[model samples]
Target chain A: MTATMPQAAVGASLSPAAVARIRADFPILQERPHGKPLIFLDSAASSQKPVQVIEAMDDYYRRYHANIHRGIYHISELATEAYEEARSAIARFIGSPCSAECIFVRNATEGINLVAYSWGRSNVRAGDVILLTEMEHHSNLVPWQMLAQEKGARLRFVPVTADGRLDMNRLDTLLDGARLFAFTAVSNTLGTINPVRELCLRARAAGAVSVVDACQAVPRMPVDVTQWQCDFAAFSSHKMLGPTGIGVLWGRKDLLDAMPPFLTGGGMINVVRYDRTTFADVPARFEAGTPAIAEAVGLGAAVAYLTAVGMERVARYEHELAALALEKLRGIGQVVVYGPGIEHRTGVISITVGDIHAHDLASILDREGICVRAGHHCNQPLMEKLGVPATTRASFYLYNTPDEIDALIAGLEKAKRIFKLT
Target chain B: MRPADDLSGMDELYRDFILDHYRNPRNAGTLEAPDASCEDLNPLCGDRIRMDVKLHDGIIEDIRFQGRGCAISQASASLLTETVKGKTVAEVAALGKDDVLANLGIPISAARLKCALLGLSVLKRALKL
Candidate 1:
């Protein structure tokens, strides 16, 4: 909440000193990949972990390493406290009233699959419509397709406009008779920031459940599930400066209680009878095995780090960063940036240069140690919407600066020159 | 954060031959009356290629490939067309990832090897028919 950075100087609000201090927190940012300074623009794919997160997991392993819960021993009790407190920390960060409503899964993909398998089967039936958007990551889209196919429900998409924003004018028709409305807070490929709050309310008005995939949004902006009034939200820890292999799925308590266990095993059982077996409650029932104990500790640290940095400042800085990158990229002839205009989007920018394919641009950038993401970004339907095979994306995060954006522009210019583009 | 003095690191990988093949790909159209045809994709990048082989008396009279992908994938596909044009089905069947990589004449990193060998996969699949 201590976001006192200047509104106009959003581009330089993170003062040279402040930027240096923030960059110092992340050890990997100091690394020189391929003997070149690392300009990591692929944070949308996965953010680098700060030393605080690294140390938290290391401290847990060195000191209180034990299986959580069902333990009376001191180390086990401490481990349980760390893990459970991480759940509480995440709940507080996202404005969930209760930590018990959060379920720890492998990643966003697994979390989406869990909901599709558990809730979709029970709530959705034949002739139902599971509505999605064209810009959804494969994680969010493929699961519903499989579930709808299995349940004989029809799959629908809210078309993305040529500007890359969702076609919100058609929401009434898309949400008509829909069992569920699944969407992303931000388009990872096109950088479109959808009206999440309005969309969720409309889904509610249309008598549909809203499931928001905030995998990209939570890291860059302030997301309050209570404010959005969504039924479920999912995101990955790694994308938020934590370690991989751990993700969070927050849902209404009553809904999770009603759904069956996603994966059945020893950890999630209440009784081991051969014939008829009972199950545990809510979060426990959903988390089916030994969980990512250290990764959870690291996630706790990551949330802590973001909290200290202030989400508003993070959002403001990234907005300026996107604006800066878009301005430069657009100046170059033949460079067409996708997604909504600068003010309407996030730090994610996907672009296409004259005849240079995305992979070729990405490879050229790699030579300069400026990491970017290319290809369809797992958004093939969105690719079809954009009418391009693939695009080069430069996604910014809190740690990125204007200088790195300059490097990206320079690298791109070199790519144009090397490829003989006028 | 300047780009290296020269793009030597990339220039070595995007050799003139590879770029030549990429820009002006040879045997890049579908063939009619093909004896055998097969398609495969580099699932990681979504780069797909389809190979059509017109066999005459157990010999490959003509071979062509059609697809869209990265330069390495398209060049590899174009190069494979030339390598297999006058060969027998048995000869083409024996081709593998190494032969394709060597033909491309570049040190392909582990990650991009799939792009380099995508055409070999299509050809091997085609020769099986």
Candidate 2:
């Protein structure tokens, strides 16, 4: 019943039965691309929604569709309660100390920008250093670059190793005198799971604030902000089987209270009198007019579904899947997979077959109804470091199966034959 | 499972000649002290091309391309070199995306249009057209 068992006995943990049960909740799994069964392997980009998440949003819009906070009518009150309840659920899901510390934005990109513009503008002075990693997705890299450029601050990076993991040997030197140490808990391009707790502690020891881009980590594994001891963390709902346009920014209560408001507008103010106005509380002050109401409900349902499934099981299942994929890819002889070995990575596999370009490989895979992302994956700097124009990435989620991995292998074989690589 | 006919598009795209062009590009190097040279990148996919051309009497006397990318991009660059060799810069300027598509002789999806058009864009830039 565990992933440690042989392949025949391993399906018990997120087993075929469990995966099939989970797959049934997703209606999009029934889709056929090019008259072939859809094998979704791009969950790292955006995960598909389950019926629970979809229904929650639908039911909210159908029954209690009203603006929150201001309306006191029956349906409005219900809508407000649903929105607040979603916030509380998300706060609890990430193990934040309090619900008020969770701020809802459009997505994880906005979450990072919120901290960069609000907390960064205040804390980061001229000549201050902002430390990052070479493996950062542009979402996690660009905001800080912009902030550093505008604030006259310098930016330093922890280089990625040959195997694509962060080079931690240089951490002390990089964190020295750094004002903020912002890094991804799991690299979107490399799939390397960083030691978030250790990195946070090191940043604290260096007298620097820590920010975590948990977009990939929060979906695949359990994330407890309180345990990480990081000042701020950001993650998106769409990558966790919820609707798009809603994400969470979890920060320390004192930090959230002290930071200036990111966007000033209606629903985020306390006293507005044609002149200047005082802002509302932490979460509200960050969330501007007309937040994603039904999207919050969908995210709440997603968290509930994940809670029911248990994140430890998801993490273990994905680890097993990644190990199986790496083994199979190694057997192919021509396939080169990126990132660290199975022990330090997730189910995201970026690969190159012989000299076949990623786009060409993805095109052939599409003919087989296989969905894989082929590009820099929004990590052009990392792509440069890896010395490849592009890579074809196959990322697994709870619904993916070993059969799908076999299909991907078969598709790659077809691509090789087309290119005459063999 | 689907019928084999549904997947014929891949064959058309990776046709033997296209693959031949990609594997063994016609003119795949940089020109030394070239009359005109330009480099461009498909930022979305990170495909890059640096084109160097030698011009004589307003004609592209010699041209070569050096870069790395997908089969479509490299093949298109190879095919473009053959198409514009010994042609007047004005004639190459008149060449459009349709001409490149006709040379490629395959249907390209909207998503892959950038990949297919990258060579021509770089060629135009090299000629300063």
* Chain A TM-score, each candidate: 0.97, 0.97
The TM-score, computed over Cα atoms with residue i paired to residue i, of candidate 2 is 0.96
Model 2 bad stretches (over 4 Å): A1-12, B1-8
For model 2, how does the per-residue alpha-carbon lDDT over A1-422 read when each residue is reduced to its tens digit? Answer: 24343342244258688988999999999999998999999999999999999999999989989999889799999999999999999888889879999999999999999999999999999999999989888999999999999999999999999988888899999999999999999988778999999999999999999999999999999889989999999999999999999999999999999999999899999999988999999889999899999999999999999999988788878877887777778878589898997778888999989999999999899989999999999998888778888899999999999889999988887787777777
TM-score of each: 0.95, 0.96
Best by TM-score: 2
* Pairs that collide, model 1: none
User: Each candidate's root-mean-square deviation in Å?
Assistant: 2.8, 2.4
DockQ values of all predictions = 0.42, 0.61
Each model's C-alpha lDDT?
0.88, 0.90
lDDT of 1 by residue, B1-129 (tens): 245448757877777788788889899889887888998877667788998888899999998889888888899889989988888888887778888988988888877888888888888777773
Backbone collision count in every prediction? 0, 1
Docking class of 2: medium
Q: What is the lDDT of residue A335 in candidate 1?
A: 92
lDDT of each residue in A170-211, candidate 1, tens digit only = 999989999999999999998989899999999999999989
